[model samples]
Every structure is written in structure tokens, then in C-alpha cells.
Target: MAKDDTGRLHVTVKTGGKRKLSSKLWLERQLNDPYVAKAKREGYRSRAAYKLKEMDDKYKLLKPGMAVIDLGAAPGGWSQIAARKVGSAEGKGKVVAIDLLEMPEIPGVAFAQLDFLAEDALHRLREMLGGGADMVMSDMAPNTTGHRTTDQLRILGLVEDAAAFACEVLKPGGSFLAKVFQSGADAALLAQLKRDFTTVRHVKPAASRQDSSERYLLATGFRRASAVL
Candidate 1:
């Protein structure tokens, strides 16, 4: 291991018998990432936890007693943070999460192993919450196919679906946050969010890698009465 400019030991991985170049590089990056180590130390599920933490700290997206929904939540990083922020453990808040994969139980989070894009998803979430949500968040991304345009479209599609769900599930004056990439949200999506929300913007938190194109689309102050489909 050699120290980088920040004096942090950089762990390097050598190409081995079965490991592909991409896998090797990914392992090396994970080993050397400070956020990964910090996540381990702090008992968080994943490094992506910091992304939501940083954004919520700055934007005040979460509040105690709020009802929140997490789309595509797995391994439960963001749900963990939201549960804490909303005091879900104390029964003062509620957090409902849905993902295609199974997730271990979290103290204050209700999880469903269901696909968010499924037709029954919105109904399931509403049943779980028993009411409208104060906030909806999604950190979902489609598997990349090495085609930039295709990847961008996939990312935007997921965000758009999440946004639509948010619009239907959130209470008046609620908020929505979802992951977007490349140049952030598409113009049409942004315009629609602006019509439904009081403010719409994109934020790239420090926890997101410098070279990464990931950005979070945040829309706050839902106006239920004037919202259009």
C-alpha cells in the first residue's frame, strides 16, 4: 500500500486468475475509498448513505415525525438514515421501503420485496403507509450497458417513474428526491416538477464521486391542488 496525497493508504489490487479488469479496478477503488471505510466504522450499510446524509443536512429534506417512502431500497442505507432523521424508532415517524430484492429488517422501516415499477406498487405503498407520505426518495439506477445514451435514458426513466409515484403519494407541501445522472434531470421532467412543486433543482453532494455524473433531483413544496398529471 502507498499513501496518496492526502496521506491515506491506497490499497491496490493485482489482477488475479478469475477477476476481470473491471472487477479488479472496482475492488481497488472500494478498498481505498475513505467513505467505504467510514461507513464500516459508523455501522452504515453502504457508502451511499453519506450522499443522502449530506444532502439532507444542507437542504433539510427530512424532519421528525414525517412519513417517508424509499423506492428501490436495498441493503437499507438511505432507509437507515431516514429512519433516524424521522425518529421512526420512537414511533414518531414512519418509513416504508420497496425493492425487488430482499432486505434485512430495520428498526423503523417497513420493507416490501416488490418491484417499484410493478403496477401494484403504488397501491402496496399506500396500504403500507395508510396515508400520504411527507417525502419520497429513490436511489435507483439501471445497470449500465456501456452505451451512454442508453444509460442516460434508463436512468431518466427510473427517475421519471419515481417522480410520478411521488406526485401521487405525497401530501401537499411534501418533497421528492430521486437519483439522476449525466447532465441531471431532463428539461421536460424539470418543467413538470416545477408545475407540481414549489421548487425543483438538482444537487450533487460531495459524497458522490468527483468523476461521477450522478446528481439528485430534488423537488419540494408539493402543490396538490394545482398539480397536473
Candidate 2:
């Protein structure tokens, strides 16, 4: 093992043992990732929990008793933070976690195994939240093809759809946050967000790896009357 630039010992993986180079590299990175270790100690499900935690810490998002929606919430990492911060576990707030995949229960998150892109999904969430939401957060990503251009299109398409959903359910003055990558959202989406919300910006939490191009697109102060919804 050798130390990384951070002076943490880098655990090297062997090339053999039927492990593909890609898989071996991924395992080694996970083993050495500080966020991964911290998540375990803090009883969080994934390293992503810290990303939301850091942003919320700085932005003062997720106030108690707010009705929150979590899209692409599988593994339920973001849901856990939302529930705790909003006091959902104590029954003072509401958190709905929606995902294509199912995970074990979190203390206060109401999990929905449904596609947020589906026609009925928005209606279902609206009904659950009594037609208004204080915040919406997404950690969704599309299944990537090996082709870079195709993958980028898929990612942007997903972000656009998520933004549309946020515009619909969010109350006036509500907020939206989503995970984005590469060059971030497309121009049209960015324009749409700026029009529909009072402020739109990109944020990269310290918990996110510096080597990764990933970041978060955050839009706050929804203008419900100006939104297409």
C-alpha cells in the first residue's frame, strides 16, 4: 500500500483472481475513499449522504416540518438525511422517497418504487403531499451507454424531466436540488430553471471526489405562477 496525495494509505488491488481491471480499480477506490469510511461510522447508507449533508449545512435547507420529495432515492441515503433534518421520524414532517429500485425502510421515509418519469408518478406524489411541496431533491442518473454523446443526452434528458417535475409540485418559494455531471445541465434546461425559479446555480460539495466531474444543480425560490404547472 502507498499513501495517496492526502497521505491516506491507498489499498492496491491485485490484477488477477478473475477480477476485471475496471472492477478491481473501482473496489480499490471504494476501499480508500474517506467518505465511504465515514458513512459506515456515522450509520449512513452511502457516501452520497455526506454530499447532501454538506450542502444542507451550508444552505440551511431542509427545515423542520417541511414536506420534502426525494427522487431517484434508491439506497435511501438522501432520504435518511431529509427525514432526520425535517423531523419526519418524530412525525413533525413528511418525506417521500421515490426510486426505481426498492431499499429497506428508513425511519421516516415513505418509499415509493415508481418511476418519477412515469405519468402517474407526479400525480401520486402530489396526492401524497396534499398538492404542495417545500423541497425536491434528486440523485437520479440514467443507465449509461459506452458512447459518451449518447450518455450525455440521456443524462440531460433526465435532468430536464426532473426539473419539470420540480416546477409542478413545488410550492411558491420552494427549492429543488439534483445531482448533475460533466458540463452540468444543458443550456435550455438552465434557462428554463432561471425562468421558473428565483435563483439557479451549481454546487460541488466537498464530500464529492475532486477527480469526479459530478456536481449538484440547485434552483430555489420557485415562482409557481411563472412555472408551466
Candidate 3:
């Protein structure tokens, strides 16, 4: 590790033997990323915690006593922030998270290891929350095949499914946030969100890597399910 002219610590990963160039680059990036360091220092599960924290700071999405649902919540970074902001740790709110991968326990989060797209997933999440949630958020991304169009389509599909579940599980005036790629393929999803929500906008928090194509669709003030139906 050495300091760059900007005084930022830089980590160099020697490339050789079993380490592929891509793997070496990824490791070097992780080692030098300030947010990764900060996350470790702050006891957050991942650097992604800063993304939610920054978004919530700007939007005031998570509140004390709110019921939150975190979809694709593996690694439990976003769940951790939600649990703290919603006072779940103090028994003042509720947080339920679902992912296909197993995550270690977070103090205030109820974790379910199941695919969010499964037929029974929504039912199971509803059972866990015992009622509608004040907010539904998803940072889920599909596995990339290095094909941009294919990856974008997969991401959009995930976002659509997450939006559909959010509509069913969110209370009136609730909020939804999901990750999306930079492609303009989300017109249909945005149209549906605009119809179901009072406000819909794109958010790219500073914590999101500047080079990443990832952006968030933030929808708030949900219409009641009855009204939508």
C-alpha cells in the first residue's frame, strides 16, 4: 500500500500464478476503497451500507417505528441500517429480509433464506411482517454474463418483480427503492410506478461507485392497494 498524490492510500495487487488479472484488479479495488475501510471500522456488514445511509439521509425514507422489508438482502448491509433507523433493535419497529443466500443474524432483522421470486416468498414475508410495510427496498442485481443488454434485461426483470411485491406489501404512503442499470429500458416499470406512487425519481447516491452504471428508482407515497385494484 502506498499513498497517491491525492493522499489516498492505494493498494497494488501483484498479478501472477493463480490470480487472474480481473481477480487481482477487484482485490486491489476493494483494498483501496475508502468505503470498504469505513464499513469495517463502523461494523457495517458491507460498503453498501453507505449507499442506503446516504439515500435515507437525503430522502428521509427510513423512520423510527417504520416497518421495512429488504429484498435480496444478502450480506445484511441494508438490513442493518434499516434495523437501526427504524428502531427495530429497540423493539420499536420491524425489519424482515429475504435472500437466497444465508446471512448471519443481525440484531433486529428477521432473515429468510429464500429466493424472492419464489411463489411463496411474498406470503412468507407478509407472515413475518404481520402487516404492510412502510418501505420496501431492493439492491438485488442479477449475475452478469458480461453482455450489457442481457444483464440490463435481467436487472429490469428483478426490479419489476420487486416492484410488484412492494405494491402488494406496502401500505398507502409507503416507499419503494430498487437498483437499475443506466439503460432506458425501464419505461414500462417507471410508468407503473408513476401510476401507483405520488412521486418517482432516479437516485444515485455518492456511495455508489462513480463508474458503476447502477442507479436507484425511488418511489414514494404509494396509492392504497384498494385504490390500485
Candidate 4:
């Protein structure tokens, strides 16, 4: 471990035969990230937990007894935070999560191994939620294609679908938060959000990597579904 200019100890990963430069760099970044270390120390699943924690601190999105739906909740980091904040463990609230990959059980979360984009997904999620959700949050990210424009479009499409699902399941005055990239496609989604929500804004939590273009679109006070029609 070597100390960087910021006085934080940075771990360097040595690249060799099978280890690609990109893999080495990513490993080094994870080793040196303070949030990664903190997450391990706190027993959280991943460093991504801090992103939701920070956002909830600022926005007060989670409340006891509120129902929450998590999209693309893999590895269960965000679901863990939501479960605790909403008191799902004590049955004060409910947290239902869906992802294409299977996730290990989180004490207070109900996980479904299904793609959120599937035709039957919304209906299944609504059944799991049991009723309209108080909040819908997503941390879904597309597999990078190495092409900047293509990657951005994919991210936009994922967020748009998440937003549309949020509209379908969220109760009046509910909230929606989803991960998005810094790209032109966000404008269209923002316009739709403005029409359906009382307030819509973008947030970049401190836990997100400084070099990353990722940000979250937070829309709150959702108008009744009839209002949009």
C-alpha cells in the first residue's frame, strides 16, 4: 500500500499474464476506494450502499411503513439499505426487488430473478409489492459496448423503462430514483418526469466515483396516474 496525494493509502494491483490492464486498474481502484473499505467494515454487501444512504439522507425518500420496489437489485446492496430504512425487518414496510440475476436472500427483502423489461415483470412486481409502492428506485446499468454513444443510449433506455415502471406502480405522492448517464437522451425522460411529478432533479451522490459519469434522476411527489392521462 502506498499513500496518495490525498493521504489515503492506495493499493496497486500488479498486472501479469492473464490479468488485463483494465482488470488490474479496476482492482486497484476498488482496493483504494474508501467506500469499499467502509462497506466491508460495516458489513454491507457493496460500496453502492453509500450511494443510496447518502441520497436518502438528503431526500428523505424512505420512511417507515412505505412500500418500495427495487429494479435491477443485484448483489442486494441497495435493497439492504432500503430494508433497514423502511423497517422491513420489523414488518413496518415492504421491499420487493427484481433482477435478471439471482441474489442471495436479504433478511427483509423479497427477491425475484426476473428481468424488469420482461412483459410480465410489472404484473409480477405489483403482486409482490401487494399494492402501489411508496417509492421505486433502480440502480440498473447496461453492459458497456465500449462505444460511448451506444453505451449512453443503452443507459437511457434502461432508465426510461425503469421510470415508466415507476409510473405504473407508484402511489400518488410517491418518489422515483434511477441511475442515468450524463447524456443527451436524459432530456426526454426529464420532460416526461416533469409532467408526472411535482419536482424532478438530478443528483450525484458523493459515493459515486469522481471519474464516472453516472448520476441519479430523483423525481418526487408523483402526480396521480389520472393526472398524467
> Whose lDDT is greatest here?
3
Per-residue lDDT of 33 in model 1: 85
Compared with the true structure, what per-residue lDDT tens digits does model 2 show for residues 1-229?
9998988799998999789999998999999988999999999999999999999999988999999999999898899999999999998899999988888999988888999889899889987776678999998888877787777788788888998888888888999999877764388889988988888989999999999777899999998684423
Model 1 quality (TM-score): 0.96
Model 1 has how many clashing residue pairs?
0
> Can you write out model 3's per-residue Cα lDDT over 89-161, one digit (the tens) per residue?
9999999998989999999999999987789887888889887889999999999999999999999999999
The RMSD (Cα, Å) of candidate 4 is 1.7
Model 2 segments more than 4 A misplaced = 226-229
User: Which 10-residue window in model 1 sums to the lowest lDDT?
Assistant: 220-229
TM-score of each: 0.96, 0.94, 0.97, 0.96
lDDT of each candidate versus the true structure: 0.91, 0.89, 0.92, 0.90
Off by over 4 Å in 3: 227-229
Which stretches of candidate 1 lie above 4 Å from their native place?
A: 226-229
TM-score of 2: 0.94
Stronger candidate by TM-score (1 vs 2): 1
Better of 1 and 2 by lDDT: 1
Per-residue lDDT of 102-171 in model 4, one digit per residue for the tens? 9999998999999887899878878887878889999999999989999999989888889888888888
Clashing pairs in 2: none
